[model samples]
Target: MSLRLRLNLLVAALNLGFLGALTWLLIDNHRNSIQEEIEAAHRVTVQMLGSAAQTSPVFGPAPVVMVNFLQSLGRVRANDIRLYTADGVLRYSSPPSAYKAGRTAPDWFGGLMRSTVEATVIGLPGARIEIVPDASRAVLDAWDSMTAIFLLGLGFVAMLHVALLLFLRRLLRPTEADARRLVATTQELAENREVMRLIEAGIEQERKRLARELHDELGQSVTAIRLIATSISRSSEAPGVTQGAGKVNEIAAGLYDSVHRIVRELRPAVLEQPDLAAALADLGREWRIRNPDIDLSMVLEGDLGDLGEELTLAVFRCVQEALTNVLKHAGATRVRLAVAQREDRLEAIIEDDGQGEPNALAGSGHGLVGMRERVATLGGSLETGMRPEGGFRVSIVLPLAGDSQ
Candidate 1:
């Protein structure tokens, strides 16, 4: 459900609960009041009639005097009086109450509010006086009062609910200005991402160009120099000349090796083939060779070779930058790199086994930031932190399905 609907439902539920509780409390109070009122009225009526029954024999025959007395007495408030002869003949009956005379409470409501006062009977020489409790009027009054209160409460709750819903709707509704600003911000973010993608693509193109120039121009020149030095060393008869030629040839070979290494770094062969596993393997081998003090371990899983060029390059560069940071900041002895392609996503983790700095990523260096940008461009995320086991860790995840090139 929508948040607005859920909130509205919550408010409605609270209102209903409050109404239910109030109703229950009122019912309990009214029930008690009716019971007490009816009981007190019945008690008084019984006592009054019982006293009159004892004195009736002094006036005349018990039945005749009581009948005359009841006819004069008229309808009692909450009792029905009747005089019956000893032969079971009904001599006199109390008149129906004129107060709410024709009306009665419903059976269910009357049952709920009715009191349990018993009928009173007085015996005399020839007749009996029966005073039965009558609570219909009292019960009807309670029902009327409760119904009025309930209706009032219901109307108030409905108005409150409507008012609250209106207030919430206004509070949650977004303004036109806010909507415009949100749209503008979203467009700006999209443009920024596009700009970053273009920048990265341009950088890669330049690197390729530089690698080609070094390989084609500088590489040939260095080869020519080495060939000339080798020729001079073989042809010269002077011992000094041979020694100088040999030295020149040795330096040229070293220079050539350095140039090739730089070209490889600029435009790795793995990028052309887009094999991340092979690229990482070559990188680890070279890293171990150069930084022999720090042992580098690499683990590749799944089909790393088929990750598109953009994703492969992004992962490789992130891992490369992370290792460089480890070497520069962490005084580590061992580094572990793991890359796995699991279904629709690629994950890479790089960790070092040296004293870790918790705030390494927050330092005044752009390495981590650059790596993050690179990964983000490929619809990926980068996380860097100090490992719990006394090292720094860098983790990256990239989505393979439907990712932008």
Candidate 2:
């Protein structure tokens, strides 16, 4: 729900709660007033009846006159006027005796008037005038007050709510506009991310093509040149001629080595294999041979080969770049590379005990950006930071479905 709607509802709820409490208090006060009215009426009636009875000159105990007086009292007071025996048996009543035990109000209303005036049970418990608290009128009066209060409160809240809505609608327009701007920015960022992914994939494919070209064309030519150098060295026995052939042989060998290194730099042949684990092992072995003075360790915990070609390639290249950075920049001697399959994801961690400052010298051109881009294209994450202990660490995570997607 919007803030305006929530606030409006809250206001309405609070109004209802407050009005309900006020209505309850009003009803309670009305009940007390009715009780007091009944008690005062009962006291006055009992005193008047006692005095009239004491002063009456009863012409041989005139019962008919007493009945007429009681009937007149009922007519004037709108109360139950009755004459009962000393044993609590009803003897006479006004407007007939049918209404003696009848209710004068609704059951809910009568329930509110729990206390009644007993009139002192004059003579005996039976021959007494009981003034029952007929709360029918009071209940109706309370009902009217409650209705009025509720309607007034609702009207007041409604008016206030309308005014607030009008004010808030104008006030929040800027916030809505800001929200729209934020949404637009988010969409632009997503489009840019997708564009970068395509660019990275293109770059990778280009590298593969270049590696293939150098391997097939330049590689063959160099092999031919090495063969010629071999033949010349064998045919020449003179020291000068032999020395020259040996130099040519040496130069050819060095050139071949450089070509091979360039090919690997472009694309490692091991990445094309189906078994990614074996590729990683081969990668670590090659690095160890290249950096004989550095200690390298690689561990594969589970069956990660099914991670597919693209994801496997990303992982391989990431590690390759990390090792290359370590070899070139880090003056440390030990490196650790670990790849593992856990649940639905594959993770790789590379750490080396070397001074790493790729981020600081990022403008100078570094492999970390390419590594990060490659990982990001797969909808994965790449983190490169210096470890607290004293070296650089790179953490990578790629979903198994990253390649398929």
Q: Which candidate number has the best lDDT?
A: 1
Q: Each prediction's Cα lDDT score?
A: 0.88, 0.72
TM-score to native of every candidate shown: 0.88, 0.71
lDDT of 1 at 295: 83
- Residue-level lDDT of model 1, residues 89-112, one tens digit each, is 999999999998799989998888
Worst 10 residues of 2 by lDDT: 96-105
Displacement of the residue 370 alpha carbon in candidate 2, Å: 3.1
Model 2 sits at a Cα RMSD from the real structure of 5.5
Q: Model 1, which residues run further than 4 Å from truth?
A: 1-6, 32-60, 68-74, 87-90, 95-112, 116-118
lDDT of 2 by residue, 1-405 (tens): 988788778777876787778767866787787777766766676777666555433633334445556666653232445666556667656553233334245566557644465534334222544433333554555556656876887788678777877787778667877999989997886777778777867887899899889989988888888888788879988888778878887888888898888888677765566577988887888778878999998888889777777778888888888887888778988999999998878899999888865563254655888888778778788888888888889999887765422
TM-score of 2: 0.71
Question: How many steric overlaps are in each model, in order?
Answer: 0, 0
Instruction: Write down the worst ten-residue block by lDDT for model 1.
Output: 396-405
